[model samples]
Target: MNQPDHEFPDESRTIRPHAGESIEDTRNWPGLALVAVGLVLLALTLTAAGYGFAGWAVIAGALCGVCLLGGIGIVVAEHRRVKAR
Candidate 1:
């Protein structure tokens, strides 16, 4: 006997995208806080250190910290949004 071809897929994977309303209630406090902290630390470190290799290292670290924090916040928000759907 010949079986009819299905238009929709018979999925077994549970990681399929959600077919529901999108939850767009994202917060900015976390990323803002990180940026603020990073700026403050960079200012203090640069002011006290004056000019040297150590100062450059400190500045790099501050920038990296800010970027890492921002990335983390974004990841968390996306995770929440996906879970909500």
Candidate 2:
């Protein structure tokens, strides 16, 4: 018994990387922005709670510090991801 001849295309193509390859930076910016905004709102709330403008200033200061920390974290994480790639 003779088997029927079947033709198949060659499949040995080499995949090449693009010239503009860059690492993806996925450091939740919106989330960080939300946290920063929340901090401002919280400070406003505190001020309205009769703690006076001074209390709001304090809250604002704290929020600023938190935002700084969060930004640093994001930068570090992005750096690590880029280095890993």
Candidate 3:
């Protein structure tokens, strides 16, 4: 009746994926995309500001803020979703 330790898995330490949910479903693609856009806009804003394009810098800076906020929101929402589940 003696079995080796390797014969059984330790359920307590194991993580199981939910049914009907693929690994890809857990990724926040949109959130990551928004963050990327925000970073790009930030670079543009700095460049414009350095060249004395006040209007362009202001516009890009505003857009960068919006994109960063939106991305953070999406990421938080996704985190809550997974936690709730």
lDDT of 2 by residue, 1-85 (tens): 9996653321133233333322233464644565667677666766655556676667666776677677657655655554555
What order do candidates take by lDDT, descending?
Answer: 3, 1, 2
Tens-place lDDT digits, model 1, residues 1-85 = 9997664433334555444212233454455556676666667666656655686667666775776578568646766665566
Candidate 2 vs candidate 3: the TM-score winner is: 3
lDDT of 1 at 39: 68
In model 2, the Cα lDDT at residue 19 comes to 37
Q: Per-residue lDDT for 1-82 in model 3, tens only?
A: 9975762334345555344332255467788789999999999999999999999999999999999999879877886676
Judging by lDDT against the true structure, name the best candidate: 3
Q: Which stretches of candidate 2 lie over 4 Å from their true place?
A: 1-24, 28-52
Candidate 3: residue pairs that collide: none
> Which residues of candidate 3, in runs, are more than 4 Å off?
1-27
Candidate with more favorable, higher lDDT: 1 or 2:
1
- For model 1, name the residue pairs that clash: none
Q: What is the full ranking by TM-score, best candidate first?
A: 3, 2, 1
